[model samples]
Target: MSAKKEEQTAAPAFNLEKAMMDYSGDKYELIVMASILAAQKGKNEEFRFQPRDKVIKASLAEYLAGKITREQLVETYMSERKLMEEKQAQEEKRLEQKAAAPRLELKLSGESL
Candidate 1:
């Protein structure tokens, strides 16, 4: 019973420093990507998170686990940005068309005198 309790109490250890050191890519880029991912995770509930999970740590863990890559992140960001810019352009075009459109004013017969 004591052995089972002890085993259950032991949590898997995660060494961020070691993981960072072992990563084959640029360390600075990794940190930047992780920071961005952490910010996104913190602001959104797209992923189910445990109450004890910290966004920064979770993001790092995902990277370490090979679930996400820096290239994938960059590509996703670029695509989303492109979509936003396209939407803005379309909105601007629509607004210009609306502004250029002609408007008609109906005059009251009683005021014509």
Candidate 2:
């Protein structure tokens, strides 16, 4: 039982120095992305699953390491944004349709529908 608790409480290992070494040039871009994403996560509950800073750092490191191309990042973000927007639009349309549907309220005082 004690061993299970210890394993569950273990902290994840992080190597910041290695990550920095992996990413080169235009650190400002990474900073901006991280800040923007962090703010978005704070306001949007759906985005809180992954920490913004970690996402930004890992993305930059992967880019520098050539694990993923910059174009891939751009494409991924654009596609995700597009999908989210589309979903929102569909939801709005559904709500509008529901609202526009006629609702019948029968009065109790011998009123006709």
Give the winner by lDDT. 1
All candidates: TM-score:
0.65, 0.55
- Ten contiguous residues minimizing lDDT sum, candidate 1: 45-54
Task: Please report, in order, the local distance difference test score of every candidate based on alpha carbons.
Answer: 0.78, 0.64
Q: What is residue 9's positional error in candidate 2, in angstroms?
A: 34
Residues 34-88, candidate 2: write the lDDT tens digits.
4444444445555557676665565444454566555655665678789999999
Across 1-113, the per-residue lDDT of candidate 1 in tens digits comes to: 69989888999677777887788888788878887677567657765463334677789878887888778888877887899899999999999999999977677985642
lDDT of 1 at 88: 100
lDDT of 1 at 80: 72
Q: What is the lDDT of residue 1 in candidate 2?
A: 64
Q: List the residue pairs that clash in candidate 2.
A: none
| Error at 98, model 2, angstroms | 1.2
